[model samples]
Target: MAQKSAVAARAPKKKASSWQKRDWVAAYIFIAPVTLGLLVFYIWPFFQNIWFSFNDVNKFNMSTFVGLENYIKLFSDKEVWKAFGNSLKYVVITVPAGLFLSIFIAALMNAKIRGKSIYRTLYFLPSVTMSAAVAMVWKWIYNEQMGILNTAIKAAGGSGHAWLTSPSTALYCIMLVGLWMTVGYNMIILLAGMQGISVTYYEAAALDGAGPIQQFFKITIPMLTPTIFFVLITSIISGFQVFDTIYMMIGKTNPAYDDTQTVVMLFYRQAFDYGYKGYAAAISLFIFIVIMIVTVIQLIGQKKWVNYD
Candidate 1:
């Protein structure tokens, strides 16, 4: 009887039920498209880019292994360094300004106000608008002669200056457009974070004789730090890759083009205009490195300010 009991205890476990197998199969089927897309579009291209960076690729699509030549050239390239500096400048200017503006707008919108949905829709419209269209409209608005901006300036007893044509102002002009485009989206994200905070905290602070400003600093900001961190990281990443606005607003012929050209713009010019695909690939890798380093630094710094609780 003891031997039989031991045998029964050691009996093979039952196979997984048919229902479990079917569930797994169904999940795989549901995810197949996205998995395949990532493999083909992102994973394959990423490896190919790395391979191309080490080779000299001609217009015929033939490659000759040149090893670190492209990378070495990048260090001495004046245009490359200028582009990098411009990209960093854009990030420095836009990220903080955008963050603060979004938070301020979100705080205002979070208050009990009339036509809140209308205001949100109006603000978010710029985010949904096509980039190309936004560029065209802003181009008209920044036109040196007839733009409304210049018109307004002249009407105010001030001289009108070329916003997109002058080297001193072109990059900053593009940065303003970028800020206008992004602020609404970031504001909505912050508003969601604001709404998620429990009213109890604010009520408790109010009972403690905390005014609105005091409650905002003491209760709202601490809880919103996580969302702020997320927005900050994403903004930095996007700001570093600024290209379209510069490309559209400051074309190659424009005198301000050099002042405003970003790293991606340099890549575009190298790959297509100059037909140096390998060099372009190297430039892309450099951009990837910059973004990764910045992201890592922000991640490390977040622990000081981000409140996961």
Candidate 2:
């Protein structure tokens, strides 16, 4: 009994199997490159941009810390205010418009219809196409002379005006292009969300004398609120940061440039064109602050409307 008790008192330490170690090694290997890229590219540059914002930076990257001088200049500058307002207008128009159109189209696409696959592919093609190419195509379409739109207007006995050269219409033209490009992607996202919903709820609603429109509002929309919220947040961010399409379609020399200039475009012009790197950095930081505040507001507001259940 004493010998057995002594033997039982000595316990062997357990070790992880080689396979477990191998699994951990594989996981780290898979994540290493992404981690390194984020650190070197995103994280580092973000901090550098913040540092540069407080200083007067030169082309050679030399800087003198000027505290809030750069920010002060930006706040006082009429051009900065104009560009910020333009960006805000862009967000206001595009975000809600894109969300509404996308939800509407997605609902239609989700319905029982022929050629649904083809319609989906056609809509998604714009998302895959390069934005610059898309912008160029739209630019020609909006050309003052010999453009398809102008040709159509002429055929209808209406005067053909330069759509992109007039301040009143140029921003709207840009917004339209953004809408065209964005609707498909958001539609697909919403369609996926709609598809994820159980059909039983819809069927039950149908059995309860609920019409299609009624089913859509009472069942589909409520269940799809989470997806809508996701798309809304992303759309707001993208809309606020709109630059490429505007830059490609409305060149710097365009008469309506000032009216259509987005915040990012203004930042580019200030940083690269005028060589005010510090001021540009400040502008970028301001944009970051705006986006952060808006996103936080959305997050807080989501509790009221974004239903996960």
* Top candidate, metric TM-score: 1
For model 2 the local lDDT of residue 2 reads 92
| RMSD in order of candidates | 3.3, 4.4
Clashes of each: 0, 0
TM-score of each: 0.94, 0.93
Task: Quote model 2's TM-score.
Answer: 0.93
Clashing pairs in 1: none
lDDT of 1 by residue, 1-309 (tens): 999999999999889899999999999999999999999999999999999999999987799999999999999999999999999999999999999999999998999999999999999999999888899899999998999988999999999898888999998989999999999999999999999999999999888999999999988998898899999999999998887777777778998889999999999999999999999999999999999998998988888555444
Any runs in candidate 1 off by more than 4 Å, and if so which?
A: 1-14, 306-309
